[model samples]
Structure formats: C-alpha cells, structure tokens
Target: MKGGNMGNMMKQMQKMQKKMMAAQEELHEMSFESSAGGGMVTVVANGKKEITDVQIKEDVVDPDDVEMLQDLILTATNDVIKQIDDKTNETMGQFTQGMNMPGMF
Candidate 1:
C-alpha cells in the first residue's frame, strides 16, 4: 500500500511540473506594452521582464522641460514593469491553482 501511494504521488508531482514548465515556456514568448503622458512615451517589455524598446515622441521633448521628460520616461518604464509583473503572476497562478505545496513552483 505504501509503495502504491508513493508511486501515485510521484506521478502527480511530475505531471504538475510538466504543466508548470509548459506555462513558463509560453510566458517566455509573451509580451506587453505600456505608455504614459498621453502616449508620448511607450515601453515594450517581454514576459521575462526585459525591456525591449522605449519610444519618446519628439514633441514631448522640450529643452527647458527636461525634468518633465524625465518624469514621463520614469512613468512609462514603471508602467511597463507593472504590466510585466501582472502578466507573470496571472500566467503562473494558472499552474499553481489548487496546489498548496510551498516552493513547488
């Protein structure tokens, strides 16, 4: 009886691991974009939380308002980071549902 139970538990664990790996792979190929200052600034980031691009509209640049431009960039970058975090959590949560095992992920 003990051996049978152990084998079953192992199989279940393996299956869950496989599902998690698949979900992670899918996330690696995913991406999200965010903008700030009325779309004057745009940021593109991948699911792995890597920034791919930062676009700033020429009209948003002012020689006398460097501080405002800096703030816009910061806002856009932070927005992109938040978006990436949300996507990662939502995607990983799908695989962790109903599983209470700590650190299993």
Candidate 2:
C-alpha cells in the first residue's frame, strides 16, 4: 500500500515539474514596463530580468542635471525589476499550492 502511494506521489511531482517548466518559458516571453520622473524616463524588461530598451524624452535631458537623469533611469530600472519578481512569485506559487516538499523551497 505504501509503495503504491509513493508511486502516485512521484507521478504528481513529475507533472508539477512539467507545469513549472512551461510557466517559466511563458514568463520569458512576457514583458514589463515602467517609468519615472513624470514619464521622462522609460524602461522595458522581460521576464528573464533583462532590460529590453530604455528611452528618455528630449525635454528632460539637461546638460547640467545629468545626475537627475541618472537617478530617473535607475528608478525606472528598479521598478521593472520589482515587477519581474512579483510576476515570478505569482506564476510559480501556483504549483506549490498544496504539497510541502522538504528542502525544495
């Protein structure tokens, strides 16, 4: 009886692993965007936590205030990184809904 239960648990684990892999692939294809300093700076990042692109408006670029622009870009990039972490948690949390595997989390 115990052997049969172990087999069933193993099958469930395999299925969950497959689902996790698929979810990770989907996440890689997703994108997140963020802006800072009243939209003067914009950043786009993918689920892989990679920066896809960055843009700055002409009006916000000041030769003497380069530090301000740098701050805005940094803020925007951090925002997108937070967003990716949130998304990853939301997507991966679904699989570990019930079972508590020791040392896996």
| Model 2, span 1-105: residue lDDT tens | 699999999998899899999999999999999999999999999999999999999999999999999999999999999999899888988887676865432
Question: Candidate 2, which ten residues in sequence have the lowest lDDT sum?
Answer: 96-105
**Stretches of candidate 1 above 4 Å error?**
98-105
In candidate 1 the C-alpha lDDT for residue 62 amounts to: 96
Q: Clashes in each model (backbone N, CA, C under 3 Å)?
A: 0, 0
- Tens-digit lDDT track of model 1 for 25-72: 888778778888999999888878788999999999999999998998
lDDT of 2 at 35: 100
Give each model a TM-score. Answer: 0.86, 0.89
- Model 1 reaches what TM-score against the true structure? 0.86
Local error of candidate 2 at 70, Å? 0.4
